[model samples]
Target: MNEGNTALTWHVDLSDQKLPRLLLRLAIPSVIGLSINALQQALNAIFVGSLGAQAIAAVSMTMPIIILLGAIGEGIGVGTASFISRHLGAGDEAEASRGASTALALAAPAGLIMTVALLAILRWVFIALGASPTILPIAIDYATILLPGSTLMLLTIVSGFIVRAEGSTRFSMWTMLIAFILNAALDPIFIFLLGLGVRGAALATMLSQIAAISFYTGYFIKRTGTVLVSISQVSLRVDLIRQLALIGAPATTTSILAALAGMFLYGATARFGDDFIAAVGIAVRILTIGALPITGFCIGSQAVLGFGWGARDFARVVKVAKLMVSITVSLSVVYSAAVVAFARPLVKLFSDSDNVTEIAVLSCIVFHLFFGFYGIQSFVTTMLQSLGRARLSAVVSFARQGYLFIPAVLLFPGISGFSGVLASQAVAELGAGMIALFVMLRQFAELRQGARDP
Candidate 1:
């Protein structure tokens, strides 16, 4: 399976490849692409930071909302990808194509409805999310432009997942790279040269999304890809949608819960001050950037895992799981140590305010204390999702941010003040990592037994 040969080969026999070699081939491009995307996000904050801490805070406030809406597309994408990979593994290309078309069908209307619904209550939602009086107007300004254009963003996300489902990660990587490059180039021009401020940032992101989706559209239309999707092939049948929903709903819920958790964290931090909000926001971006490789690895492993599970290649699945978990854990430890050591310099990149820098450095250190454990939680969750174990996946996914982190954030602050707030996520990571490890061990045992039985 020469992955470099991208001339109209739609499906690759993922199970035929060596596990380590294949995983690296798929994951490297994704890591580079996602890392660049994360860097662009950090750069967006740096560009916006010139306006003031309040401006940075305003942008930070909108993240939860953006994530909440984006989760819809992500859900569709995950479900679609899972379906496509499994069908392809079973040597059913038609089913894979149907899954792709159905995903697009679902994403289009969902994006539109989300835009309309969110626009109606934009002000109130931000306010409830802990935007102060001064930050409220700025937050609204940013969200207004970003929210309405979310349809483009949604389309790009789903399309990227669809491309990757067929083991075309290079295409997925190119789309993301194009978007990141375009967004990075456009950010300063729009934010400063065009004098659009935060709204300009929003515009730049939308334009980049337009570029990404355009590539995807061309890929599908020309039938130059693994899955051939056309207008005539699109289906809205009840069973098909339900099949997608069953796998997708849990993934969507996981993200939505994280978004809600962000809102809750914002509310808790708000009482401390806008500086706290700004600091926390910066730390969040830093964490996101740091975790990109781990995310990329998990995402890259998905196609392989899905195909193995679908084909009942239990031994292959087990091998992939062990290798993935070990590599991700090692990467996380290295990144976390580096971040903790260089927290000050990284925080200073986004803000010059001594107060903001000080708070942000602290936040980064505490948030990443148990960060290595996150690799465990993330890989297991991805494995479960790839295996279509939605119920268990959701439980593991929710633990890090939802049930565990929420209570820790709410109660810890009262117990130990601001430091407690920073520690909440670390505690949650440790607990969730344990949960994931327990599940992984049991899952591997079951797979081993299955392999012997048949």
Candidate 2:
């Protein structure tokens, strides 16, 4: 590693071999890193579950709002990743740094605004999400403490994107290493030993995010890299922000819709009690775990395709996108079976209460009925984003998270309550996956022909 070129280091030699081999090289590490994150969050939820149902329910309600704001981080980081990856592919280092600088400049304000608005919305956010009065106090306390720190989280995310796009996965991985370990270690101590209750949980999370901030910030400043997006590089201009947001906004908003949809699901299932809510929360975390492979492949393809698009390597982009969809869908069969086979033990990992366990186990199977299809959807949407096919990707994004999922949540609960709510997610995924598959196939064909899409 060249000490002076830390930022430029990611602009490495990409092998021109078979696409599957290349995708695997990227996907394996991404899977490990994403799994590590999932494990960290699961640990917190597991430990908190031991404290009782309200504690679990409190965390559950707080998650939607936290994740809602987390959209900025995902969106901005992705923008950075998209721009930097392409710049690297084009063999342009200086522009990549400027994009990196601009990303941070933009991320800072988004984080700041989220911090303040969440402060005022803390009480109402939960209430709006159908949180009952009994649990509202604890939920508010947790959200209030953790919400303000969303800014640091956004910075940390974009920083990782910049570094990773520069072909510095090791550095990006190491940063997560430090933050995840710190967060995991402090979680048990703060929640149990310090007896901080919900506040303890928030404190642990806050400290971890702040540490991530320091680790990433120090990496750029102290690293001998030319990624110095200085005061001059920072901009609040409409063009830069617009470009970044165009790519990121859809991904971010997709996550926001998921959070918002959770609220509707909550309303539908509330009659069953907090146990159901807590069970659903646990189910989500577990489901997300299984989807990691799909997520990783999507991200990996984004890099490959985004770069290909930037360089007018249309053939490579087409091959990569088609291969990614095929490989991901094939892998999903294995993932779904594994989950269904071990659903019982997986549910027990989160809660011992028979009622919670029962609901969780059942929810796990039902929620993932169309599990394989999620891979198809992830592959298509990520490919579109990487290729800067924003219009197509945005459609993929909105169909699954906003249009299909949200409406299902509202309509299903009215007809069938718990069953309806659970079924709605599977329906949305199934619908989106089918549509994305058709569109992705069509796009790949168009790319190969060097013809404009109709």
Candidate 3:
């Protein structure tokens, strides 16, 4: 079949195929792609760690800002994808194309705005996040290089969404894979070979993201018939923007809240010392390597759910949700166990300092013990997004990162000190998981009843 026919066939299969087969077909490439990206980040930390605790802490400090920017991009991407998939499910190719085009058109401006905003508030944000004086300058330097490249990062995510909306998971995966491979090759060369230190890591990352954006732009141009992005089709339609924000706002909040939680965690940890900051930073990056694949699966399955729900195929929605939740939770268990078992070795990869190693190892084990709960929450939120239940998704998403976590981090630390800080995450995860489970069951039950009645 030609590319256009292939894209249409994929949309048909999303609604027609068995849930297990469809989920795997869509989810696997995304999982691999996200996993490689996470690995590249870990490697970056490992390389940058050699410079000292200040460098590591600086990198850690910048994470929340980076995440907030990413939240915006991915939020738009997810909302755009949801809109497109729903249209495709209803066999409205023209509407789907319009969403694809509008999302692409918005990417650059959105990115540019984020760049300027982050740059203007760089110092204040870091200070509020509890960066030490020694780490502040280093953090500023890194952000300077990275903020301008926000345009590329945002567009890359938007492009991924467009491709995946057309059921081109492999194409999306390859875009990330190729970029990550290039990043992996460039990190050491920039950081050590050129002696650029922290700035080198930022430069390497920014360059890699630009490459990803170029690849995505080329893909769309080459496959124009499959994934259209025309200037004429772009519009500031109030309804379209509202629909995007309805889902995208809460989705973005989920990540922004997560970033806020991280900032809070960093501030709390900084009280102990800079080494602690560095240690927690290393542990979080390591944890990401495992957590991202589960998220990738959730993200990948969004298309499947959107198609089913838009087609009013409630049975398919339920089946896909069940399989995805089960698979992700199981994977989280295995991943958590492995990380805990090799915590010391993993920490060592990033640092040789005994103090940093001890803290990172303990943080690694404590933070991941409740991995199953985190995975459950992620699965439910993604399903909610797919069902276009943004409010409920927002509620569940808030619980994991902001609602429960903020209170737990504040109160628990006073009660138990350092251990309390570590345990607070597990507590939040458990609470959020229960709430997500309740909401998901309720939603799915209603969906099934509706299907039976009609």
Best candidate, lDDT: 1
Root-mean-square deviation per candidate: 2.1, 2.5, 1.9
Runs of candidate 1 exceeding 4 Å displacement: 1-12
Q: Candidate 3 residues 295-383, lDDT tens each?
A: 88997898888988889988778878888888998988899999989999989999999999999999999988887776788898888
Question: What residue runs in model 2 are displaced by over 4 Å at the alpha carbon?
Answer: 1-12, 15-21, 223-228, 451-454
- For all candidates in order, the CA lDDT equals 0.87, 0.78, 0.85
Clashing pairs in 3: none
> Largest TM-score belongs to which candidate?
1
TM-scores for every candidate against the unseen true structure: 0.97, 0.93, 0.96
- Write the residue-wise lDDT of candidate 1 on 77-187 in tens digits: 888888888888888888888889988987999999999999999999988988899899999999998887899888888998888878878878888888888999999
Worst 10 residues of 2 by lDDT: 7-16
Candidate 2 has what TM-score? 0.93
What lDDT, from 0 to 1, does candidate 1 have?
A: 0.87
Q: How would you encode candidate 2's per-residue C-alpha lDDT over 340-395 as one tens digit per residue?
A: 88998998988888999999898898877788888888888787777766787888
Locate the minimum summed-lDDT window of 10 residues in model 1.
1-10
Instruction: Decide which is better by lDDT, 2 or 3.
Output: 3
How many collisions per candidate?
1, 2, 0
| Native RMSD of candidate 2 (Å) | 2.5
